[model samples]
Target: MKTGRRLTSYALNYKKIILVALFLLTISVGTDLAGPFIAKNIIDQHILGIESVWNETTNGKSTAEYQGEFYKKEKNFSDNEEKGKEIRILQVGTKFVFMDEKLEFDGKRTFEQGILTVQKGDEKVNYNAKVLTNKELMAFYKLEIPGIIKLLIVYFGLLVISAIFQYGQKFLLQKSANRIIQKMREDVFGQIQRLPIQYFDNLPAGKVVARITNDTEAIRELYVTVLAQFFTSAIYITGIYAALFILDVKLAAICLLLLPILYGWIILYRKFASKYNRVIRSRNSDINATINESICGMSIIQAFRREKETETEFEKLNTEHFTYQNKLLSLNALTSHNLVGVLRNLVFVAFIWYFGGLSLNPASVISLGVLYAFVDYINRLFNPVQGIVNQLANLESALVAGERVFSLMDEQGEKVSTKRIERFCGNVTFDHVSFGYKEGEYVLNDINFEAKQGQTVALVGHTGSGKSSIMNLLFRFYDCQKGKIFIDGMDIINIPRQTVRNHMGIVLQDPYLFTGTIVSNVSLGDPSISREMVEKALKDVGVDRVFKNLENGYDEPVIEKGSTLSSGQRQLISFARALAFNPAILILDEATSSIDTETEAVIQEAMDVLKKGRTTFIIAHRLSTIRNADQILVLDRGKIVERGSHEELMLLKGKYYQMYELQKGNASLAG
Candidate 1:
């Protein structure tokens, strides 16, 4: 019900179109039932009725009386039922004489144009009376031909009108459904922006993509197929019931008993169907996640020669997804359209037996026309019921999609304060900070650090020593569990995330590049950075030497992830990107880790220019990279164990000094 309500809220935005469709749908359904009713009328009143045989020789009206009412009156009887309802002859000198033998119509009636004839004067009309006996007599009572033509005209006209409205209703519904899908997609994409980083850390990339794209598309089917058909079917069922009740109350009452049985069957089907559908959806998400991972890691898989292993893992996920889909298919086969078909056949069987018993009893008041109409109405009712049953799978899929979409929307993200700070001094302070990425597991214990404006602070340690963790806290990616971080002597926790990150620029060990021109990647599409400025920044960072031979220079197109570029080229471009931003607080996380020794040797000039007036924090494994740092903090097991200049740290011969000696000896051995 909650899923249904959420979908309804999206639908209500386009209610005007929906309401128009509904009105047209009602008209179309009402017109459809008219065909069966018209057939009943032609069978009961026109061809099969006690039609008169008129004698043209007689002048004026012969007073023919039945039930004490004169039906042979010469006046027009089309408007007045009482004056001449028993019989009607519209021509002058017309007389229709009632015969003694009254034969009821036992079969169907077929009408033809320009074939009806009436005997005039004493003309002897020799007709073949032995074979097809009623053919000649049917022509004799053909004086009511004009009235039958009028009824046919009305019936066909209604059919044309019904066709028009049916087309309009379908077209409008499709348009409304498309608009609704667009809105739903927009809302899902917007919700993705508000989710936390940790939320993404737990789920796979492909799973998130499936929810944003594939799942929402499933909901689109809910609007197009399930919604339109379900609404039309409901209206059809109601119209069918009303027609049946008007025909005969007792028969309609018996038909109503089938509702509870149908409802119970639906309940049973949904119980199993929903469960299998959920499993199918979950497996499909897993399949998407696996495929995305495989594609992204294809280069690694091939380089390491793990193609067979990767293929085997992908096959396992695919097989699991396929197995669940088969289970859902099996569930559908047992209890969907087939079940509705069974119920329809049973209803027809019951209808026949009940009506047959009435036909045998002499005291029963029934007509063939009424029985024919009832059969038509019952069939009409079950047709839509079958359609609705067939759409059950779509409803289940849409509901599951809704649940996933809403779950992402409900996740808690960083509380972004509205207060803005356009600029900040480069000063940063960590006051007795203690932090952890998980509950009750402190990765950074009682950490204290400080970097004055325009000073370079270098963090060096072995792996898992929390050097990167300190940068994470400084950038406000994750808040510390205890104590506070201050910028320019003011706590930054109350500042908005966008505002705080605006003055910071980060260049990481592995720089990510989007599909675009090199200049756009360098400037990151910032309008303030002109083309000339992007060029200058690239030159300043020594990236021009790497791509000088490329055709378009900085304007060259970069393919996905910049896969065509060398590792050094990618890292150099990242440096230019950070330099172009000119952030007050600069962080380099092994930023030069990928560059060759010769290229790194030249980029030092660009690095000095970038860190000139900004508070810079360098996280590096190479002790040679931090030789000129104003302050060096050596971390061990989440605590800053030593703090001094590079020369001062070498004198202490502590953990930092030991790491320096090992790397220096390793380089000497390789040379």
Candidate 2:
């Protein structure tokens, strides 16, 4: 919940749209609340208000005193004031009119269309009358059937206006939801960029991808489904309660008990729901990671014939995911939605029982119209409750998703310096640097080294001897546990990683290419490298003949990971890529290991040109390539076991000499 609240802060940025949506939502609720009251008026004023009939007698010639039921102007007038009174009407003239209850004039009168029209000299006046025999008058009182039709129209208009407002609010809410999602995705992506290399080393690619794509997608549901339902339900509940209070304060107060019951249910629901949702989310991430790993390692899996084993593992994770999902489903069924339905029916039963008691009272005044409206309002109240209950499942998933997304965003990464360095000399130094990917297990200890401007330094070592770790340190992919690294005599910690790496380039053991054309791969989307630069760099790598067979040459399409191309061809492109950048410092880690001896020989001169006047670090298992290097460091178990020129190391007869002799024997055998 803490994490969800924090993630919700991003919504504060789009206050304008949210506020407008809320306003529309409130107005919609107001229109809906007007419904039952309009219904009550239709019943009390126009539908059922006419039931009492009057009979009377008077003794006179052509004079009659007709006794009729008295009608009060006020609907709720005190019963104590007048329990029952007959309206007295008598004829005093040739028109045979006795008297009118509400209006009196000494003149001839005639009743037409339920209107008593009186002619007093030249002036004519009209007054409404309750015609006992007229079936057109639907009410006991004064309102006519035409008035009932107009009331129905007004009632329907309120509903139509409510529908319009509801549509507007729902549309605006979803729009705000999408905007909030966009902002969250951007933050997630930006955080991924700043995280340390070890973070990726420890976590799977698919899990991180899930955090950015899947989890954030769930958060979007939070806004569109959960929050939308929450606000709507809240407004509806409030309106129902307000209407109830207006009708009967005692009954309204009694209805408030269900609120705390609902609140407690929600609190309990969240406790269990969050636990189940967490496991569900974790399993989802694991499934994604498993799929990604399977795809990437398909070749190895097929080579080893582990298809059955792979399927078994995937089934385990898939089953675990589904099991937790079932638990959540069961919890939802038992707790919120179905429970609200039961609770709603319970409230309705209680209301009906209470209203029936009031109707039985001889003296107690109770309008049947108000009793119907009470039932209607109570039903309205529970609809929102059931609505909120229906969204509980979605709400649980969204809150869980919010927890994961904000937790990722909260991860501390490499600090970014405000300074941007455009240029720097290529003199690099590592002063007593000690580092480890894990605590207390150092991969490089007290590693002191320097590669001056235009110097070529070679790091030759066995596998797991920290050659790549040193490169990792130099690139600031991981900060050292101790000591400082200097680039052009500037401490690297103070320099932005981008700025420090501006003059450095690395060609990894396995080069990666994005989905693009050959020219784009060489340029790597750097706008500074024009077509001319791309062409020159490709030709300079001495692999132009291989590309010349394609109709588009450098323009030929490169699929993902350059899977269609040979390893040698990919290496040549990567070499061209490094050279095109023209960095002051270049580090090649097994760059030529993939190429055949003949191809290496073909590009040897171009390689020289690429390495010319640049501080270079070459890590290779092949001893022949580094014979001309200015200095060579042989690392054994995180320590530099030997450091000298090839000639100097050969004379020393140490670890370097032993490896050289072994490699030379292998080269002879291969030949």
User: Which candidate comes out best when scored by lDDT?
Assistant: 2
Local accuracy of candidate 1 as per-residue lDDT tens digits, 385-487: 8888888888888888888877776777654445556667899999999998898899998888789999999999889999888888887777889999999
In order, how many clashes per candidate?
A: 0, 5
lDDT of 2 by residue, 75-134 (tens): 334455432333323222222222235444434567765566766556677765644432
**Model 1 deviation from native, Cα RMSD in Å:** 6.7
Candidate 2 regions with alpha-carbon error over 4 angstroms? 52-143, 415-418
Flag regions of model 1 displaced more than 4 Å: 49-148, 363-365, 415-420
Error of 1 at 351 (Å): 1.7
> TM-scores of the models, in the given order?
0.87, 0.86
TM-score of 1: 0.87
Clash pairs (backbone) in predicted model 1: none
Please give the range of 10 consecutive residues that has the lowest summed lDDT in model 1: 123-132
Best TM-score goes to which candidate? Answer: 1
Worst 10 residues of 2 by lDDT: 55-64
Q: Looking at candidate 1, what is the lDDT of residue 573?
A: 85
Q: What is the lDDT of every predicted structure here? A: 0.78, 0.80
